[model samples]
Target: MSFLQRYKAGIGLGLYAVGIVIGLLFAILVVWADFEAYDFQAGLSVEQKTKGFSCPLAITSNESGLMTAEISNNSTRDANATVRMMHTLGSALVVNQVEQRLTFSPGQTHKLSWPIQASDAAWDRFIMARIYVVGSMPPRSTADYCGILLINSPFFTGQQILVFTLALALVFVVVGWRMWFVSNKQPAIDAEKSSRLMIAFAALVALNIFLSINSEWLASGPLLIVNLLLAVAVLANRLNKSTFS
Candidate 1:
């Protein structure tokens, strides 16, 4: 086959692979954005009044599921606020640690974000988030605040999940068809041609590896899968050439 014909046939497969990866990422981001934040009022009860800390506002998560707190200092002086996000599962404690720290001046409202990653598996079990705050008071005293923080599940609607599954299935179907069924048999390639094809395949493998490092889905399963498909394609092509040469 001429170079032009080879390009024409390969372009569709390449596009499908790239499309599936990009589409999957876009869908996750969209779903996360839709259900990212939860507002929890803190220090409102009479119990909090005795402690001298105030202004419990909101807690939110970013697209990556990092937690953040929107709080205002109601005290008369600057205070150091330490916020913690604790994960609990059905009367069992799973995770509890400090999430963010911020210094707030009197009446200052600030949004402090922490790198708290909530795994997808957290949804399968009962999960609850509690935000705790410890603030510095005058005369070396410390005040404490605690409240429940609610974060909605990203996959609750399930639309994005369905879309991703369909797109992934389509990608597999197209790539499988080209690799196992579609014939690319030709006369035996010279050493130079074989080397070039090997180099191209190596480049594809490297690209997939790089992408997988940045994507959990690809790193976990899809990268190895597609590489296996590519290997089978190459082996089948070579076997056909050797047989018919």
Candidate 2:
């Protein structure tokens, strides 16, 4: 059995290799892409609100080690609305900064969580969290807000994840070079002559892995290159079989 056969590997290894490479690279990018993650909304409502009405909310940091905020629309009026949050890092907006629309319906109740960083840690710490509504006709009602801030999790994985980033970069380097014409073996023989496609596909696969691993990270271009290689490998295998059969 050849080395690949010993590993029970064929086209699958290409996919796995691409995955690992992308994951590692993504973790590295996440170390810097810590954008407070408040960009994605969790709630949206379509009601109108009155200026004087306020809502009551309870925010807390639980054993799960996440900062959570819970909002309840305690108003007589139907509050068709959209929700988002904003937090200042270090008590000022000049440094670490983040703001977002909340992800909740006027009649909906949900929580939002974030990894603690240089900015406002979470809803738990804030006594009164504020939210904005998009709809013109918001319910004339009261909303409540409360949040928790956990002193950065004791089991935070940032350090370990960062350590894995180096490996990802190395693999991406291989994929990148391969795509750039360092090797005669074209990853994408399926599309006639497509070295560039292989590279692109490799890069995307790497990016997917990066996101999976980082859970906190975003992809740099290197990850995309790695996944592109994986795609190329898959494409190449299919082409070889068709030619022989």
Candidate 3:
């Protein structure tokens, strides 16, 4: 017998384990990088507020939308402030800086709006908005951010895609390990088919990881569903012994 025939089970299990590990590591790395980038860009010594900021999480490429921020002067004095919004793709700015200077009386709130347009490039981008009072001691300021997806489809958000990816990974990891034992007992043709199926599944996992890391959640979400269906079909086929004969 050849080496693969002698150590088939071990080899299959080892490959499955390696694929799972690599996929998980890549997923973690992507999440960590996103957090680090957001913190670096928007995590100045200023207070961050999410309540007053509103922007769509996903938009079609080359589309325009409105982003609004509510500025309130709660202090017992008139406040002069500058509100600046920056649209960026990765580390690069995608549009001209939008700035508005306003004066607010005590107990007054003003809602400001800016027109945001997505680029033709189908990628993830950010809108960073800052409000700083003019001549305030120690620089009283607040910052907020919104992540925008520049894709044709707006069916899924990043969080939804992430959850689906993780769930699919868990399912594949379990089913793939069990497949090795089943393939080991099959005839040569059936064993070859099972091996091919496993390899294809692994490749799909890798592709999903790439799309997710690049923030292509629109594509990644559907791909993950397809992968789940493929896994289910393969598992059902394997369980039916007559299919192999």
Candidate 4:
């Protein structure tokens, strides 16, 4: 037997293994970079009693919502504070903002709220609500943020979408590997089908990476599942061809 026939199975298996490993590693790298870019109150002492904020963590696209902040003067004297609330798309553009100055007597607490809404264009993007308080002694300065999801699906939440995608990908990978190894005559890889699948997979990967980096995991999860399903269909078709031939 020539070299081509002698090690075809090995070559096929190697390709699949290498592709999966590289894809997973690339995904991890993208997630790591995004995490590093997130701001989690580094180098600041945050006191919840002095200044704190609350808002819904997730909302549908084009939905109206409210963001509230509570400021308290825990000290023995009166305090002057400036509180600012901002709504932004991703991290770059501010969509709405309000600023107010308030005076609080000792042991007094005041609550402030702002009306907020997410546009349809903000779907699959984060509606970031940030609260900044200045001129509060002991607290000095404080910041709080709420990341709202502009959800695309009403039936499923972001976490559910993510889990389903992962499970589907794993099933496809396992089934494809078994199909390749179980048959005595390994299926001949079709160049045209393989190329098309690769192109589709690459496109999805790029789009998913972009969405993930922007904290749009809910949007990317569906694409991830679709890519894996396409992969499974292509592999099954190729194997069936070999079986009939």
In model 4, which runs have C-alpha deviations exceeding 4 angstroms?
1-51, 89-91, 120-124, 153-245
Worst 10 residues of 1 by lDDT: 54-63
Q: Model 4, 156-215: lDDT tens per residue?
A: 554454455445554544444443444315234654455455545655665765665445
169-236, model 2: which lDDT tens digit per residue? 55555554443343333245633355455455546655565554433233443544555466568669
TM-score, ranked from best to worst:
4, 3, 2, 1
Instruction: Evaluate model 2: give its TM-score.
Output: 0.30
Better of 1 and 3 by lDDT: 3
Candidate 3, which ten residues in sequence have the lowest lDDT sum? 129-138
Candidate 1 residue lDDT tens string, 1-245:
66665564456445444544454444333222222211222232322312322211212222233445566677888887665555433233345445667788887877655443333213332223445655674323232322222234454323344345446645653563354223333444653464355446545554553443333332424554666677678668867976998
Off by over 4 Å in 1: 1-46, 49-66, 88-92, 115-123, 137-245
Q: What is the lDDT of candidate 3?
A: 0.57
Number of the top-ranking candidate, with lDDT as the measure? 3
Candidate 3 C-alpha lDDT tens digits along 11-129: 65655755565564544444333333353344446644434766554445446667687777778887777777765533444434667887878777779887765552213543333
* Clash list (residue pairs), candidate 1: none
Candidate 2, superposed: residue stretches over 4 Å from native: 1-16, 19-156, 159-163, 166-192, 205-245
Question: What is the lDDT of every predicted structure here?
Answer: 0.44, 0.41, 0.57, 0.56
